[model samples]
Target: MAISITQFASDSNLLNTPLWDKQSEILEEFWAGNYAIAVWALGRRSGKTLMSAIVATYCATMLADEYKRHLRPGEKFYIISVANTIDQAKIALQGVKDLINGSPILKPLIVRETTDTLELRNGAVFRALTASSRSGRGMACPLLIFDELAHAVDTEAGNAAGSSLYQALSPSVAQFGKIGKILLLSSPWIQSGIFWDLYKQAASGNFAHMQVVQAPTWEVNTTISAEFLEQEKARDPELFKVEYGAQFTGNIAAFIDNQLVDAAINSDRGLLPPLNKFNGTYYLALDPAKGGRDAYTACIVHYDGELVVVDQFHQFAPTWGDGKKTQVAVSLVEDWILEQHKAYGFASVVLDQYNSSSTIQRLSGRVKIRELTWTASSKTEAYSKLRELFNGGSIELYPHPKANGQIKNLTVTYRPNGTWGVSGGTGAAVDDYPSALAGAVLMATNRINKQQIIPAKSYRTW
Candidate 1:
C-alpha cells in the first residue's frame, strides 16, 4: 500500500513534539519539492542534523512505497548523506536510525543493516557516507543531503564533497529525472565554494532549480541563548556577526582560507615522522610577547628549496605579571629554542629584533641567529611568502589545533600605504602563532634562495 508523505507526517509522529516555527515551514517546503536543490545557510546548532535525518528517513521509509514504484526492476532507491568526517556523516545516520526505531509505521520496513547502509524491505536504502570523492560511485540515490558543505569544500572532502557529489549522484537520478532532490546546508564559512554560489544564484532569482534560506541561529532555533550570543558578540563582534548573524562575511579577506590550511595539515604520525623527531635542516622562529595577555611563539620550518614544511610549532600566553612575566616568557622561549636547536639540528634561528629582547644576544654565543626588524614592509614580505607556499601547495604544516586555529583566523589587511599585512581574524586568541610560522618560512626559504645566488658547484656559501 502506497502512502503519501502528508498522511505519514500527520499520524506517524515523524518529528519531535512542538517543532520550532521555521522548522515546520522548512519541512513543509521540503516535502512539497518546491525546489530540486535547496540551500540552507543556517547558524551553528540550528537543528540541521535532525532535520536532515527526518528528510532522509522520510524519503527512505514513509515514501518508500511510492518512490519504489518508480524504480526499475532490481533498482534500489537510496537516501544519502555525505559529511566531512565519518562521525559527521553518522550523525545523520543515527538520526534516521533513531527515528525509524521510534516510528511505529516505518519501523517494520527496516529489514537489515550492512556496514554502511540500512536496508528496507520496500527496496529502499539509507546510506551514511564520508565525503570522499569516491563515495558516490555506483549509487542510485534520489535524495542527497550535504551537511556542513563549507567544511566539505575546505577539507579532505574537497574532491568528493559538496558540489562534487552532484557529478557522481546526478547520473543516478536520470531515472527520476528532475524529481531527485539535493539539500546543501551549513554554517557559513569562506565566501567561496558551491554553497555560496548557490545562495547568490538563488538571491538573483535567476536559478529556477534552486532556492536559498538564510537564517540566524535564533531565527531557526528560538530556544538558543540570546545571552550567550550577546556575550560572544562582546568578546569578538566580527566573528559573531559571521557565525550567528547569518552574514556571508567575505572569505577573500582571510590570509589563509580553511581549504589551504586543511590541505597543508601534515600530521600522520606513522606515515611521516614529525619535524620535532625527524633529522633534517630546520629553521627556528621565535616571537616574544610585548605586554598584556599577548602570547610568546616559536615555530620551526624546513625547506627543500621549493616546499616549506613546518615541523614544530608552540605558543603560550604569559600569566599577567605584565612587564615581569614578559621577561620570564622570553627566557623560557629562548631555553625552549635552545633545546629544539640541540635536538633537531636547527641550521638557523630567526627572530624579530623588536621582540627578541636579549634572547638574541644570549643565544649568539651558542647558535647562529639572525635578527630582522619587523616593519610594515618586512611583515608584508613574510606574509607574501607564506601565501606563495600555500598557493603553490608546497607547505607541509604541523597539525596543531592552536597553530591551525590561528592560521584560519588570519586575515589580510591592506594599509593606507598599499602594503599588505596579516592580523588575526575574528575569534582568534592571538596572532603570534601565525606570525612565528611566517617568520620561520621566510627564513627557511631566504636561507636556501640566498644559496642559489652562489652557483651550487662554484661556492658552498649561503
Candidate 2:
C-alpha cells in the first residue's frame, strides 16, 4: 500500500496531537497530486513553518531511500528549506528539530546536526538557507521549501527576486522528475512576484499538475477569534485586507527603482569631508526620534552645480539599557548636532516639526532653522522630489548602510485621503534614514532653484 501523509502523521510520533482539519486537507491534496510545485497563500499565524517542517521531515526520513534511487553512485541530494533571512530560516529548521525531539521513533534517525543542517543516517540531508539565487545554485535538491516567499524581493530594484531564484533551482528540482517537490508559502502581499503568477496560473488550470491553496488564518488555525480579527480590521482596514483576508493589496508598491538607486550610490566613496572640503553651500536635515522607538537621524548634503551629493549621515541610538530601561538624553543629541554645525556651517537646516521643538530652540541663534510641518500633501511633494533626483541622476550618495537599506525598503501606498504615503514595508522597522535624506534633497533643490545656479533644463524634474 502507498503511504498517505495523514496516516504517516497519525502513526509516527511527529505530532503530540492530531493534525488540524484544514492542515490535513492541505497535506492530503498535495500528497495525492502529481504536483511539482505547491504554492500556499496563507494568512499570518497559519502554521506555514510547521507545515514546511512536516513535509521536509517526512521526505528526508521515510522517503529517503525511494528518493535516492535515481541518483548516480554516491551522489548527494538535499531537502532545502529557505526563508527571507538567516534568523527566519533558523526558525523553520527549529520546527523540524522540535518534531524530531518530541518523537522517540524519529529521534534516532539523526546521525549529525549543525546550525543550519540536519543529516540522517540514511544519507538524506535537510539544510536551511537565506533566500538568494546564489545560494540555490549548484545543488541537487529533491525537496525545496520557501517560507514567507512574498517578502523575497530584489531590495534595490524593488522587484521580485523569486523568479530568479526559482529559475536557478528549478533545473535541479526538475532532475528528480516525479520525485521532486517545491513548496512555497507566504502571507499574501502585493499582486506581483512568482507567488502571484503561480497562483493565477493554478487558478486558470494552466498547469494541470500544480496545487495551490488559499487559506485564511481562521480557517487553518481555528483558534483566532472573530473579535480579534474585528479589532485588527478596525485598527487598519487596508492592512487587514492583506494580513487576515489573505488578499493582494493593489495600493502597495515599491517607491524607488533599483537601478536608479544603485547608480546614485558612490560605492568607492565614504562620507565626504565637512564643509571645508567643498566649495558649495551645505544643507542639513533632521528627523527626530519619537517615543524611544525610532532612531534620531540626520543628513547633510550640498548641490555642486550638477548633482546633490550627500556628505554625511548620522543615526543616534534611541535608548540604552539591558531591557530598554533607559531613554537616550535629548540634550546629548542636541550637542551632537551643534558639533556638526560647527564643522559644516550649514547655510540652512530643515527639520520636521514632530518632537523637534526643543532641538530647534537649542540651535535658534546658532543656526538658521527651517521648520517643515509635514502634511499629507507636503510629504508627497518632498518624497516625490527625492525620487525625481534619483531618476534624473542628480543625486550622489555616500556609503551609509542604514540609508541604503531604508531607501530599498520604502513603500508607496495610496491613502484614502486622496494622497500617497511613503513609508517602510515588511522587515523595515524605521524609515528615519530615507526621511532625513529626502528632506536634505528637498532643501538643496529649493536653494538651487532660488539661486538659479544651474540651468532650468538641468534640474527641471530633478
Candidate 3:
C-alpha cells in the first residue's frame, strides 16, 4: 500500500512546516477511505491552497499506480485544481510547484511543467484551470480539488449557476470507486450553490460517504490573533462573519429575484443608441466610486410611456499605484459624461451627493444636476423603485454580463440602525452597476409620476 499523505510529505520534505492539527485530521480521515467526497468550509487564510497542493502532490506521486490501473493502456491520469478563475487556480498550482522544487525525490518525477499544467514521468497529469462544465468532461480524474467553490459562478451563463459544472465533473471520479475523491474548499457564502447542498447533506448525517469540516480562521490558523479578528469585525461585521468566522451570513439575503432580472434582459440587443430625432428626454445617472473596491458607473436611460430603455452603460476601472492605491480619474469620468450629454442632451443628470461634490461642481453649469441626498429612506426608495420596474417587466437591459451579474448578485441586509444595507456579495463583488441602475429607474419613475400629476404635461414626451 502507498504511504499516508503525512508520510509522503515527510519522505519528500514537501512541507516547510508540519501540518496543523485540523489539517492533519482532514487528511487522515480522507486517507482512511471513509468518504468519497470531502467538503471543507473553512475561513480565509486557513492554508487551503497549501493543503490542497499537498493532496495533489501525494496523489500524483504515491497513488499514481493505483489510480492508473483503471485507466486505458496509455490514457493519462489527471489531478485537477480548478477554481472560479484561472488566476485563483494558479495559486494552488504554484504551491504544488514550490513543493516539487523543494523536494529532491518529487522534483525528478516532473518530466514536464508549464504555467497551468504539470506532467509526471509515470503519466500522471496535473492541471490548473477556470471552472467550466465543457472543460471537465471525459477526463479520468482520481483527485479533483475545487478551490473556492462557493464563489464559482458560471461566467459563460452570465448568472449564478454552479450545479452544471459540478454535475459534469463529479462523475469523472466514478471509475476509481472508493479510491477516487473530490475535495471542495471555500469560505462560506450565501445559502445556495452545490457547495451548500453538499454541506447540508454532510451535516444531515445522511451521507455516510461524505465528510465535511467547518472551522473559523482563528480556530484553524493559531497565528491569527483575537485583536486582528476584532478589528475585522469592527470594520465589516457581515463580511467578517463570512470571511473569518466561517459563518454563512443569515442577515444578508438576495435582494432581487434572479428570474425577474433575467426577464428584464434583452440578450439580442447590445447597448442601444440614442434616438436620431431627439423627440424624447434622456436621463443620465451616475454612481461615483468611493475607492478601489468599486467601479465608477453611469447609465443613460430613456423612458417612453410604456417602456424604459437603457441606452448606454459606462464603467471606469481604477489604476493601481504603489501600495495598491486605486486612482479612478474623475476628470476622465467627467469627460465621458459630457460626451454622453453631447450625444443625448440629457434633461436631468441624477447622482447621489456622496463623494461627488467635485463632480457636481464641475457639471453645475454644463447640465441640470438633480442631487440625491442618500439617507436611509432615499436608498430604500430608489432600490424599491428599481425592483418594481424589474418585476413589472417595463425596463430593458442590454447584454452586459458583469453589470447584469451584479444586479442578480445584489443582497439586502437590515442593519441594527433601521437602515437597509444593500450591497453586492462580499470579496470582489461590487454594486456600482446596480447603484446606477437604481438611480436611473428612480428618476424615470419620478418623471412618470410628474407627468401624471400635471394635466398639461401629460401629452408631452419625457
Candidate 4:
C-alpha cells in the first residue's frame, strides 16, 4: 500500500524532518485538535512566519481536503492570511511558497502568483490579506491567520474593520462540522490592546490554547551572539528587551539605566512588608503639567526600610478644558490615598509644589501634603538614589499587572553635562511616579532621629 501526499506529509518522518522544534509540536497538536484559536508568540527571527505559512499551507491543502470529503462538492474552504501591512503579508506567503517549493510532492499541487497566494489543485486557496479592516469584509473563510495582529490599528470611530473581518469569517467556519480555527501570531507591542486581550484570554485558559513560545534573540539563531545582546543591553536595556526579549515594553528610552529597571522587577514573589511597619509615614508625589498630550502622573509611596511604591495614577489632558478634569482626578487620588491609609496608616503626602500648589493646598487641609522642591541638580541625585534603592532591594512594587505596564514605559539616559535624566516614553511623560517613590524612600530612610532600626531577624533565621 502506498501513502497519499497528505498521509506522507502527516507522517512523523516528514513533520519532524524540518527541525521540528517546540513550536511545531504545539501547532501540530492544535491543528489535530481542531482548535478554534491558537496564538504563537515568538521573538525576532524565530522563523515564526515560516511556521505560520506551513500551517496555513497545510490547512489550504490537506485540511481543506479532509473538510471537503466530509461535505459536498463546491463547498467553500478558504485560508485567509493577514499581516499588519501588504508587505508583511507578502513575506508570510513567501515562506509558504518556499515550503511548497522545497517539498517535491507538495510543489506540484501549488500554483504560485506574484501577488503571494497559493492556489492548490484541490480548489483550496491561500490568499494573503492586509490587516485593514476593509480586507476581511464580505469574505467567508474557514481558516484565519493574523500575523503581527498586535500592530493592527483599532480605529476610534467604532470601526474595527480588521477585527470585524475575523468576526465575519466565523459563520463560514462554523458552517463546517469542525470549529473554526484562528491563528494569531505576533511579538509583544503595546501592553493594552486588542491583541493583548486575546493573548491574555488564551493564556488564562479561557480558550483551548496551545503554547506561548518566546524565542529571544539568543534562541533565534547563532548570528545573534550574547556579546551583541550585551552590547545592546549596555546601550539601552529596555530597548534590548523590547527588541530581543520579545517583551512588548512600551518606549522607555529616556530613563537612566533600563538594565537597572529590569533588574528591579521582582519575578519570584510580589509580596512586600507591611507599609506602616517599614515607614512611620506615607507620601504622594505629583508631577503636574497643564492638560496637553501629557497629563499629570501621581505616585503614592510608603517608606518602610526602603521606599515602596504603593500605587500610581496617570491621566492625559490635551487642553485647559481637560486640565479642568483634574478635580475629578484629584478626588480619585484622595479616595485612593484614604483607602491606602485605612489599610496601612501613613504619615503625610509629599508633592512637587511648583505647578500643583492649588491642588496641593486643597488636599493638604484634609491629609498632610508637603511640597518638595525639585532643583535641576536634584533630578540626577533623585534618579541615582532610586537606582541605589532598587539595586539594594529596598524598594517593593505592588504586584498589580498595571505596574508592569507603567514600568515598561520608564527609561534612563545620561545628559551630556554629566547628569542623568529619567524619562517616560510610549505616551508617558513626567517622572512623577519614580520621583514619588524615591521621595518616600528618602523620607523613610533619612536619619531624622540620628538612629537606625536594625532588623533582629535574618534570612538564615527565617
Q: Per-candidate TM vs. native?
A: 0.57, 0.59, 0.59, 0.51
Clashing pairs for predicted structure model 3, backbone only = none
**Model 4 TM-score, 2 decimals:** 0.51
Deviation in Å, model 4, residue 255 alpha carbon: 3.5
Determine which window of 10 residues in candidate 1 has minimal summed lDDT.
Answer: 452-461
TM-score of 2: 0.59
Candidate 4 lDDT (Cα, 0 to 1): 0.57
Model 3, 1-462: lDDT tens per residue? Answer: 646777666563555547877788778887785688999999998999988999998888888888878999989989988887778878889999989878877788888989989898999889987875467678899988888887777645521456677787889899999899999988887676677888899888888898889999988888878899886765445567788888865546777778878888888888777786643388888888775656778888888667888877888877554646576887887887788888888777777776777777778778776676666676787786676667567789988998999999998874321245788867643788888988877776777677321111111122
Model 3: residues with Cα > 4 Å off, grouped in runs: 11-17, 156-160, 251-462
lDDT of 1 by residue, 335-391 (tens): 787787777777777777656647777777777777767776677767777876775
Clashes of 2: 2
lDDT per residue, candidate 2, 402-455, as tens digits? 788789888888432124588876432369889998878777777777742111
Error of 1 at 235 (Å): 2.7
Error of 1 at 261 (Å): 27
Runs in model 1 deviating more than 4 A are: 1-18, 154-161, 252-462
Cα shift from native, residue 385, model 3 (Å)? 25
Local distance difference test, per candidate? Answer: 0.70, 0.77, 0.78, 0.57
